[model samples]
Structure formats: structure tokens, C-alpha cells
Target: MSKDAFAAAALALTAAAENGSNMCLSFLNALPVTHAAISTLGAPFGSETICASDSQAARLEELQIDFGAGPCWDALRTRAPVVDADLSEPTESAWSLLREAIRDTGILSLYSFPLAIGELNVGALDLYATTRAALNLPLIARASALADLAATPVARQVIRRLPHLDTDDTNPATYSRREVHQATGMIIAQMRVNADDAQALLRAHAFTLGRPVREVAADVVARRIKFTRDDVVDRD
Candidate 1:
């Protein structure tokens, strides 16, 4: 891509993060790779969210969350470069399921790069390739730099989107736990019930479903799905 195109994509990423959508995620509609995500953050801290350059990469991340193993996990755990080369070629026999899935999708290589926001381990950006060498060092360096630049908008978006918690409050509880509270509040407002009553209902639903309260809250807020007396914790 041209430098101008790179700049425009980066700007779009910033805007998306500011919108409380996702942090530094952009979908490269056309590329040799299947997908990519950038973490607009540093290490020793928590990530704002997940960002992807394409949908396939996004699916991989989601699958990783479900499977608990993949480039995303390796990237976050080691903070180093991960390469799958090709799903048909595996380093070991253990990742059979992952390998099969990638093969079905025609994704040949994978890379997940860590994004740090100051001292925090903000999050990771993932990339999918049709070949092993799709990401050169220069591209990795550029993506890393872009992730570093995206932190500002991510922070701004967090504050703007969640007003109940103090914006300056670095308490992850406010960010995570309070996310549950915020969702509960929205549900309460919608149902025209008391805050305590709403909290009880949501908490009960989350516990029954075996999901984290914050995650439940997010579902409620996004309206991607709904909750009910018989609702179980929905794991994605």
C-alpha cells in the first residue's frame, strides 16, 4: 500500500477505537494475508480490546479464545513472533484441530504481534497469511509503530463510551466489573426496574450461564443477544 493509504487506514483505526468499537482494528479488504489485527498498546498493562485487519484473522482470534491455544495465545504469552507457516505443515501433532481449521480456511501462515500502551500489555493484533513470509520485518515494525500510536484514541474512546466510571480511573474493575454494572444499568433502564433488582437478575443470569459478569454486561449493552430468567451464560 502507498504511504497515503497506510496513513488513511491508520486514521480509520484510530476513529474506530475512539468509537468504543475495537482498538486499532482495521480490515484490509485486499491483501495476500487472510486477516490482521493490531494492538494499540504496550506490555505490563491490560489491552483496550481486539482489533483485526480482516475477518479471517478475527475468526482465528475468536477460535483461540474458545480453544485456548493458537497464535494469539502464543503471542500474548511469549510476546514474541509466532509463525505457523502452513496448516498442512505443523511443528507438532498436538495442534491438529487448529491446523485442520486453518487448512479449511486456506490460511497458511499466522502472526500475532503484541501492542503495548505505555507500561500496560494492552492487547495483541493478529495476522493471517497464505504463506510463511508474508510479513517482513519492516512491515512488522510499521504495524508495531501504528499500534503504539493508536493508544490515545483507544483511551479516549473508553472514557467517552463509559461515563459511569471515572475516566481517569485505571481501576480495571471500573473497566471490567463496572462494564457489568453499566450493562445492568442499561437493562434496568430499559425494563424500568430498580438498580438492585436489575443487578440481581443479571448476576443470576451470568452465574447460571457460567460467564463473567462483565462479558454478560457487554452482551446486554451491545444487544447482540439478550438475557432472560432461563438464560444461561453464553460463551463465544
Candidate 2:
């Protein structure tokens, strides 16, 4: 892709972010794929298809979430691009169930790029091609770059959906609270997740218990609440 084209794509994504438009379409218009989808996977945001160019694209994401394996999962886990250039002659056996599920979907190629901000593993942006095709190194790099640009807006969209989070608060103190930061670090150390995921976990736990996030953070800081990989334990 030319620099001009890349700039145009970025502008389109910016417009979508500002107007609440479907951002996935920007990928379809800019990339070589026929379909595209963006999703939030795992904790903090949970698993959800935020946008898809078509039903098949949405189904692909759904299948990945259901089976717990797919290019999207792999991309997010490894923080790298995953490309099954020829799905009919799959290069890897990691997503057996996903391969079977998408067999007759006329999707001959699939690509996934991890979305993240620093160490925060957000989710993935997936692209699908109905005909056997490969994204060369340059295209892969471009897609990855675009995915990086898309992560912030996608994260914002998910964060806005959290009932307990006040996105409109401009008070820096609300975000810079000492207890919250301490609790987040504790969760990161306990669960082996990124800072963003750790914070989201705190908010999620607080939301579940109908308590203020600060209170939950205080509990965690006080060692009255513990976070495990599988569950949150109240030491109190």
C-alpha cells in the first residue's frame, strides 16, 4: 500500500471512531480481503464481535470464541499476525475445530492481527478471502499497522459498555487513584495479565458485587481480595 492509501485508511478509521460508524468496513475497503471483523476477546471486555462486514465474517469470529481456538485466538495469544493463506491446505493444525466449522463457508483464506496498546492484549481484527490468496510481507505489515491503529477505538467502545465505568469523567484523580493502581498491579502479578486487563478485572469484579471500584481496589490492596486465574477469591 502506498503512503497516501495508508493515510486515507487511517483517516477513515478516525472518522469511524468519531461518528460511531462500522470500522470493520474500513479494513475491507483498504485491504485485499473480502470480509473483515473486529472483536474483543477474553477478560475485561469479554468475547464479543464488535463489528463485521457480513454474516460470514461474524460467524467466523463466533466460531473462534465457541471453540476456544482459531487464528484470532492465536494472533492475540502470540501477539503476532496469523495467516492461513490457503484454508483448504491449512498450514497448521492448531485450529482443527475452526477449520472444520468454516469448511463450507467459501472462505479460502483467513488472516488475523492482534490488537493491543503496549502490553495490553486487546483482541483481533480478522480478514477473510473467498479465493485462495496470500498477503505478502508488505500487506501483512500494513494490516498489522492498521490493526494497531484500530485497537484504541475498539477498547474505548468496549469500555463504554461497562456499567460501572464512568468514561466521561475528566478528573485525573478518578483515573490516578492510588488504591486502584495498586490493586491493578497486584492483579497483574497474581494473574499474569497486562495492566489494562488487570484494571478491567478490578472493575468487573466491582461491577459484579455492586461495589465501588475503589472499594474493591482497597480490598485487593489490603489483601482481603485475591485474584486467581480462574476466579476472584475474597480473603476477608
After superposition of all CA atoms, the RMSD between model 1 and the true structure is 13.9
What digit string (tens of lDDT, one per residue) describes model 1 on residues 1-236? 55675677677775665455654345353234567665323232223334655566566666665665666556656756566665666567555787678667877776666543322334566777777667666666665556555533443333233323223345575446657678877766664555654665555444434565566677887775454322322334
Count of backbone clashes, every candidate in sequence: 17, 0
Error of 2 at 130 (Å): 1.3
lDDT of 2 by residue, 1-236 (tens): 78888889989987897689999988888887888999988865688899998888898888888888889988998989988888788455877767866767888888899987555556999998888765778988998999988886787677668776434246666544788889989999997767866776676666556677887787899999988744456476
| Superposed Cα deviation of residue 189, candidate 2 (Å) | 26
- Per-residue error for 10 in candidate 1, Å, reads 3.0
Runs off by more than 4 Å, candidate 1: 1-5, 19-31, 37-55, 93-96, 151-236
Output the worst ten-in-a-row residue range by lDDT, candidate 2: 166-175
Please list all clashing residue pairs in model 2, or write none if there are none.
none
Model 2 segments more than 4 A misplaced? 90-92, 166-236
What TM-score would every model get versus the actual structure?
A: 0.52, 0.71
